[model samples]
Target: MVLNERYNYKLSYSTRNSLIMIDTILKNAGKLLVRLSAGAMMLTHGIPKISRLFGEGPVRFHDPFGLGPEISLALAIIAEVICTALIMVGFKTRLATIPLILTMLTAAFYAHADDPFGTKEKPLLFIVVFIAIAIMGPGKYSVDGLKKKKRSLF
Candidate 1:
């Protein structure tokens, strides 16, 4: 009976080698999804605002928090453009999420505070995604992952 159990264990171990391949595929897919979502969201919102800043549309902004329109626009551009690019490229993904999360929080607090929960749902969703990315990392396909590997070789 013991010999039979040992043989079965060996068989299972050999078959389990495929698990690594599955894990690799899943990790890559997840990385792609995260990059696309975060990157696209940032670009869609940031590009227009940036264009407005530089273009002839309107440089003036209405600050919801009563600080100043210029201040608000500057902060929004930084979080949307700089952080989004970093996140998309998987460079310092975890750290990049800090600004993204804060940006979403500010949007929710200042812009969506008086709105209904339905109106605030988008920012809330972004907050959750940013938090999840911060915790889970950018996965194996990211620059951060590559850096870790290179560092470990020493």
Candidate 2:
């Protein structure tokens, strides 16, 4: 009977340890994914804009809704490029998502409005993912983590 009790305790301890390890791994993975997705998204769009800014490519402005192509493009560059870097680094993630969310919404509503919903899948997906990131935050590993640590120290 005593041997059975010891075995049960050992099993419980092992199970607890495994669960803790799994949780830590998952949390870290979530952080990495969030950073990469947000970062890559920014990189994909920003690089082209940066190229245009440097006069490597023609700056194409499609202001069908009359929002002004130049203004829209400028805002896109700020949100997609600047905010994306902030999000990737996990610095002020919540704040970063605000602009990102607005940019996605503008793209979906103004730019891709004429496109069929199915055809506008890319912007739609970006909107959804941006919203998700806004809500979930930058996860465990980030500048936010450092800020949190600093806060705890004080």
Candidate 3:
């Protein structure tokens, strides 16, 4: 009877460990999915802006904050393209999301302030995902997770 009890206990312990491992894998997978999808979608927006900014013509972009059209477009590119790539790679992910969140906020509030919900919905969704990523982090499958050599910013 004692031997049987010991075997049962071991089985239970092993099962518990397996469950914990599965949970961890799921969480990391979720993080990676969010990072990749969001980065890719935002890049679509940023990439087109590049041609507008660098093309041989006068830069004509929305100057929502009075920062001038050139500066505004530049900032958007930095956030949507540069920062987004960082987020996708899971490098300094939390820091990267900051610029993205700011950009989305500006888009939803300043640029589309008077627009209908259909127009504003996209930025709002991006804001929620970026906020969640900033809070939850890049997870164990990322560059940030692989590098434990030093203290990270996030």
Each prediction's whole-model lDDT (CA): 0.80, 0.77, 0.92
Off by over 4 Å in 2: 1-18, 54-59, 63-67
Model 3 spans with C-alpha error above 4 angstroms: 1-11, 149-154
Tens digit of per-residue lDDT, candidate 2, span 37-153: 757966797768765655745667666456676666777788889988998888898898888878777777877788888866777787777788778878778889778878999
Off by over 4 Å in 1: 1-11, 56-58, 62-67
In model 1, the worst 10-residue window by lDDT is 1-10
Q: Which of 2 and 3 is the better model by lDDT?
A: 3
Ranking by TM-score: 3, 1, 2
Itemize residue pairs with steric clashes in candidate 2: none
Pairs in clash, predicted candidate 3 = none
For candidate 2, the per-residue lDDT at 79 reads: 88
Global lDDT of model 1: 0.80
Better of 2 and 3 by TM-score: 3
How does model 1 score by TM-score? 0.82
